[model samples]
Target: MIRVFGMHNIQPLLNKVYPKATTANGVYIYDEYGKAYLDGSSGAVTCSLGHSHPRLIPYIKQQLDKLQFVYRSQFGSEEAEQLATRLFEHSPERIYAHSFFVNSGTEAIETAMKTAVQYWQEKGFPSKQQFITRWKSYHGITVGALSLSGHPLRRQRFESTLEKYPRLKADLENDTLEKLTEEFVQVIESIGANHIAAFVAEPIVGAAGTALTPQAGYYQEMKKVCEHYQILFITDEVMTGLGRTGTWFGIEHWNTTADIVAIGKSLGAGYAPIAATLMTDEILEPIKNGSGLIMSGHTYSGHPLSCATANRVLEIIEEEQLLDNVNTQGEYIKQQLNVLKENYPVIQHVRGKGLMLGVEFDPARKGFQQKLIERCFQNGLLVYPSVGGPEGKDENGILVSPPFIISRSEADELLAKLDQSLNEINQ
Candidate 1:
C-alpha cells in the first residue's frame, strides 16, 4: 500500500476528500478504484503535451544513458546548448540571445531579478535596485519571486519579509487604464526612475482567475514608461508561453518584447522540471563588459536530461504544428465558454486567451465552487480553483487548459462534463 509520510491533518488542494492513486495514458488519470478522469486543467496548466508522452521517455532515457548532470558554472553539455538555441529560435528574433537554465519557475524569476540588479550596477547605476510588479500576479514561490509577486493569500504569512524591501505600487482592478498608467508613471518618477532596476509582470495575468488583460495600447505605453526610465521590462511567461496563448509567447500577442523573459511549465511540456530566463543582448552586454560572470547558478542548472526532454518537447510541438491546434481549439473553447456564460447566470465572467481560460462563479450561489468540483469529479473531469479572492465569494473559478494535442471530440467531452457539472451545482 502507498503511504503518505506527512501530517495526516495537512490539507491538500481539495479539502473535502483525499486523492486516490492511479495511472493512465496520455491525458487520462485513473483513481485507485479504477475510475478514469480527464485532465481538463492539465494539472494546474502544466502537461501541455499531456501525461506520459511516449516520445519524452525515450529522449530522457537516451540522455540518461550519456549524462545526467553538468555543473553550469564549470561544465556544459550539447543538449543544453541545443535547447537554448531552440528557445532563441522560437522567441522573437533579435530579442533573446542567451539563456540561463534552472530547475523551476521560481528559480528562473530569482535569476532574472539578480540579472536585472547586476545589469544596473555594471552599467554604473548602482542605486537602481528596486523592482516593480503588479497585484494578483504570480511569479513563483521562492523568496525573490515571492517578493516580486503580489498574490495576497501567498503573501499573507510573509508580509513582514516583503515589507522591508523596495515596494512596488500594486495595481487595483478599479483603476482605469489612464489611472493605472498615470499612477505607474508617478511611482517610477517618485522612486527616481534611474534607481529602479526592473518592472516585472505577466503579460496575461494568471493565478487570480486570469485577471484582466492590459488595456489596448497599455503594454506599449508601459514599454515606453520602462524605456523612459531605463528600467528593464521582465515578462514572467511561466504560465502563458509555448503556445498556451495561441502564440509562441503571450507577450507576443501584444506585439511587445520584454528585456528578459522567464519561461517554465510548458517549457519542458511537464515531462521534466526545467525553466529558462532568456534575455536580450543589450541586457547581457553590461555583464559581459564588466565581471563576465553570472553571479547566480545551481549545480543542476543545465542538467542534460531535463534539457534533452525539453528539446524533444519543442520538437514535438513544431513537428505536430501544435500552435495551429492551440489557435483552432482555443477558439472553440472560448465559443463554448461564452455559451456557458449565456446559459448560467452564476458564471460571473468567462475570460482568458487561448487554452488558458477561467470561469469565475458568482457568490450569490452558495456552495457553488465545492458543488462544481464534486460534480465535475464525479463525471470524470478535473479543474483547479483560483488561488485568491474572498472566502465563499465564489471568486472560485475553473482553469481550462487541456493539452495541445487534445482533439475536437475531447474538447466536446470536456464541455459536456463542464455543463453537467454546472447544471448539477445549480440544483
Candidate 2:
C-alpha cells in the first residue's frame, strides 16, 4: 500500500504539505477536504478545457477502447495522421506541414532542436549547429532544450553541463525593433551564421518574462534576418498554441510564420500527454529525401490513445468556438486586471493575449509575490508564478490564465476571488 500523505514519493514542494486534489470540474479543483480552488492559472497555463470536461472524458474512453498504444515504427494510426493534419491546418499559412509527435513540451523542444540540426545536416551544412535565443525566454527543461533557453534560475544548478548557445540580451519590453533585430545580426556576425542551427523564441515570452510582448514588427525583422543569414527560425509555441491565444498559433497575431514550431500544453489541453515538432515542407523534404528519416523519436512518439484524445480535444475547441470566447473573456479579464493594477500599487505590469494573461508585481517588495500567492490560495484561487523584474530573475510574476471554456459568471467569481486575495495581501 502507498503512503497517502507526508514524505511521499511525489513531492512538488518538498518542504511544504501541498494540497491533494480530490476532484475537479470546469474551472474549480476540489481539495481532499472539499474546498474548491478556482483554477485561475489553468494548471500551469495548460488545461485549456478545464478539469474533467464532460465531452472529453467520453471521447477518451472511446479511444481507449479502440487502441491504447502503438510504437511509431511498427504501425501508423489514423489518430496521429488527423492530429498532424489538424496542427498543420491551424498553423500560420499552413507552412508547418509536418508534425513529429512527442509526449511533452520538453520532448517537443528537444526534438525541435534535433530537427533543426538534422535539416541543416541533410542540406549539406552540418556546421549550422549553434542556435540564437533571447535572454528573457524559456524553451523547456531538458538539457538539450535548456541549452537554448536563457532563463537564469532554471539553468543555475546545471550551468556547467549546458551548451553555450548565443543568448541575445536585448529587452523585449523597452528595446526598439531595430535594436533588437541588430542584436541578432551582431550575434550572428560574431558567431558566424554558418555555424548556427536556428534562432528560437517564444512569440509572447511566458514564465521567464511574465507575458512580455515585443514590438509589432519584431518577428518580421527577425524572420528577415534568419532568411538573410540562412538560419531557421523556430517558435516555441508550447504555451501559446491551440486556442489559448485567440489565434490558433501565437505567431499568426504578427502576420508571420516560423520554419519550425514546437507546440505542447494546450495541444493536449489537460486531456492527454501529447506534443509535436512542426515544420514546413522545405524543412522536411530534404531530410525525408536524404536521410529517409527524421533521426529523432521516442517509444511513445505516436501513442494512438494519446493522439486520439488530443484530436478530440482540438475538435471540441473548434466545435465550441472557444477561440471567440478566449477573446471575449480575455478582454474582460484583462480590463479588470488593469483596474486591479490601478488600485494595487504593487502590480507593475499586466500583459498578455487572449486567455493567457500575466501580472507582475514590484519585485523590490520583499516576499510580495509569495504573500499574494498565499493569500490567493487561502481565498480558494490558484495562480502560476513567473519570473519578472529588470533582470528577469525575480519570482514577482503570476500568470492569470483561466480555462477558455470559462463563462461570464465564472469569470466574475474568479476576479472577485483575486480581488479579495489582493486585498488580503494589502493588509
Candidate 3:
C-alpha cells in the first residue's frame, strides 16, 4: 500500500485517487493500470520534450556517470559553464551575461529579486529596496516571489507574511498604451521611484488564466519607465521561456530587454530540477566592482546532473527545430480554440501566445471551470486550472501548454478531447 498528500486538499488522511505513473512517452503519461493520459499541460508546462526521450536518456546517463552533484561555492562543473555559454548564444546581444542556476522557479525568483537589490546597493542606492509587480501575474511560490505575485488564492493565507509591493492593475478592457504607461508611472511615483529596486512581471501572465497578455506596446512603455527611473526590469519566464512561446523567450515577442530574467519549468524539461536567473552586465558590473561577490548561494545551485540535462534539452530543441513546430502547431491550436469559442458561449475568450494558450469560461457559469477540468480528465486529457484571479480571487479558466514537440495528430487529439469534455460539461 502507498499513501500521498494532496497538493491543496485540507484532509491529509483523505484518499486521493492519483494514478500511479509508471511510464511516459511522446506526449502521454501512463499509469500502473496502463491508462494513458494525454499530457496536454506538459506536466504543468515543464516537459518540453514530452517523455522518455531517446536522446535525453543517453545524455543524462553520460553526465551521471561523470558527475551528478557539485556545490557551487567549492566546485565548478563543465555542464554548468557550457549551459551558461549556450544561454548567452540564445540571449539578446549585450543584454544578459551572468547566469545564476538554482533548483526551482521560486529560487530563481528569489535570486532575481536579491540580485536587483544588490545591483542598486552596489550602485550607491541602498535605499532602493522596494519592488513593483503586476496584479494577475505569478513569479513563484516563495514568500518573496509571492509578494511580487498577485494571484489571489495563493497569497490570501500568507498576506500578512508577504512583503508589501505596489501592484499595477492593467485594464484589459479599456487599455491604451499611453494610459497604461501613465498608470505604471503613477504607481512608481506613489511608491517613490528612488525607493524601488525592480519592476517584475510575466511577459505573458500564466497561472492566473487568459495567459493574460498585455496590450500592444505595453511592455515597451513599461520598460521605458524602468529605464528612466533606473529601476531594474525583470521578466518572469518560468512557464513561457525556451520554445514554449514560439520564441527563445517570451520577452522576445515584445522586442524588449529585461535586466533580469528568471527562467525555469522547462529548463530541465521535467527531467531534473533546475532554474536560473539571467542578469545583464548593468546589474552585475556594479556588484562586480563593489563587493565582488553575489550574496546568494544554494546547495544545489548549478547541480551538475541538472545542468547536463538542461544542456541536452536545449540541444534537442535547437537541433530538432522545435521553435518552428511551436509556431505552426500553436497557430492551429489557437484556430481550433477560436472555433470552440465561437461555437460555445461558455468559452468567453481565448488568449496567450504559441503553446502557452488559455480558454476562459464565462464567469457567470457556475462551477463551469471545475466541471470542465474533471470532464477533461475523464476524456483522458490533463489541462491546468487557472485557479486564482486578480486580488486573491477565484477565476474560472483552463491553461493549455502542451510540449513544443506535440505533433499535428497529437494537437488534434488534444483538441478533440477538449471539445468532447466541453460538450459533456455543457450537456
Candidate 4:
C-alpha cells in the first residue's frame, strides 16, 4: 500500500512508522493498539481544550447543521458577527476595531502584512511597503508569512522566493528599554520609516521555544518608536493569543497595545481551521475614507462554521475559567520542570508564562532533545522538539504548552512522565 505524506518533511515519513491515532480525550491520545500518549504540547499548541471538548462539540455540530459556509463578500452571518464581538469584548477597548477572519494562522499573518502595506497606501504612502521582523521567529508557512519569519531552517528552502526583510536579533536579555528603543530607531533610520510598513514579532516567541520573552518596558519602548515613525506594530500571536500565555493576548503582559494582531491556534481550539487579523481604527479609517474596501480575502475567509466553532471555543474558555487554571497549573508545571532541571544538568533553562513553557537543553549535548522526545514517545508521552535560532541547528529544547484546562494532578502526571523520560534518556 502506498501512503501519501504531508507537510515539508516528506522524506522522513518514508522510513518512520507513525502511530495510528484511534481516539483522543482530554489530555491523552490513544493509538490503534490502545497505547495512550499524554498530550504534553497540545498538538502544536492548537488543542487548547484538549481532545473532544464536550461544550465545543455541540456548538460546532449545531453550526454545521444551520450553515456550514458563507461567502464573506456576498453575505455575513450572525455567527461571524458574534465571533467578532467576542474577540472585541476580550481585547482592550477602543484598540481593535475590526476583525478579518481567515482559515489559518498563516492566512491571518499574510492578511496583516497586506493590511499594513495597504493601510499606508490608503494613507497616501505607497512606498511604505517594507517590513521589519526578528531573527529566530516563526510566523507561518505561506510565502508572505515565510518572508516575515526569521527562522533559518524553515526559510532556507524558500530563500529564493522569500523577501529579505530587515531582521533584528531577539535578545531577551542584555536588552534594556533604551537598547530596545534604539534598535527600533536604528531600523527606522536605516530604512527610513516612511518606507517601512510594519514591525512584526511574536509576543512570546513560540516555535522558537516558548519563553523567549522581552524585558520589562521593551515592547512599550518599541511601540513608542513605531508610533513616532508611523510604522504599524503587528504582534503575531498565533500561538500566544486567546489565553495561551496566561492572558487573552500575550502583548497584554507588557501592558502595551498593538496596531495589528494575528491570532490563531487556540482561536478555533483545533475544532476548526480558523484565524483572524485584528486592527485598530487608526489603520482602518484611512482605507475606509479612501477606497472603503479591503482587497485581501480567501474563499474560506469568515466561514460561518469556523466562526461559530471559534466563538464557542472562546465562550468555553471564559465559562470554564481555564485561564485561572492556566495560571495556577502553569506555575506548578514550571516548578516541576525546574526541579527536573536541577536533577539533570543537561536541562539548562526553563522559561515560559502560563502553560506555554520551553525547556532548553545545553547544546553541547548534541541530539539530546530529539533523543528525549523519541524516548518520551516510547514511554507514552508526547512533546514538541524546538529549534532555538539560526545557531539552533545544534541547540535542543522542547515546548511544554499543555491545554489551559490541565489540572494540578494532570500537570503532576505530565511532570512524572517527563521525569521518567528524562531519566531514561540520561541513562
**Candidate 2 on 87-165: residue-level lDDT in tens?**
8887777788999999999899998899999999999999999988988889899899888877899999999999998
Q: Candidate 2, overall lDDT?
A: 0.91
lDDT of 1 by residue, 70-115 (tens): 6776788999999989988988765788999998998999999999
Task: List ranges where model 3 is wrong by over 4 Å.
Answer: 1-15, 387-392
| Residue 274 of model 4, lDDT score | 95
Best by TM-score: 2
lDDT of 3 by residue, 133-217 (tens): 8778888888889999888878889999999899888774357888888888899888788899999988887896468787778
Compared with the true structure, model 3 gives a TM-score of 0.96
Q: What value of lDDT does candidate 3 attain over all alpha carbons?
A: 0.87
Quote the lDDT for 397 in model 3: 81
Error of 1 at 30 (Å): 1.6
Angstrom error of the Cα, residue 346, model 4: value is 0.8
Candidate 2 Cα errors over 4 Å, as ranges:
1-6
Score every model by TM-score: 0.92, 0.98, 0.96, 0.96
Clash number by candidate, in order: 0, 1, 1, 0
Error of 3 at 271 (Å): 0.6
Clash pairs, candidate 4, are: none
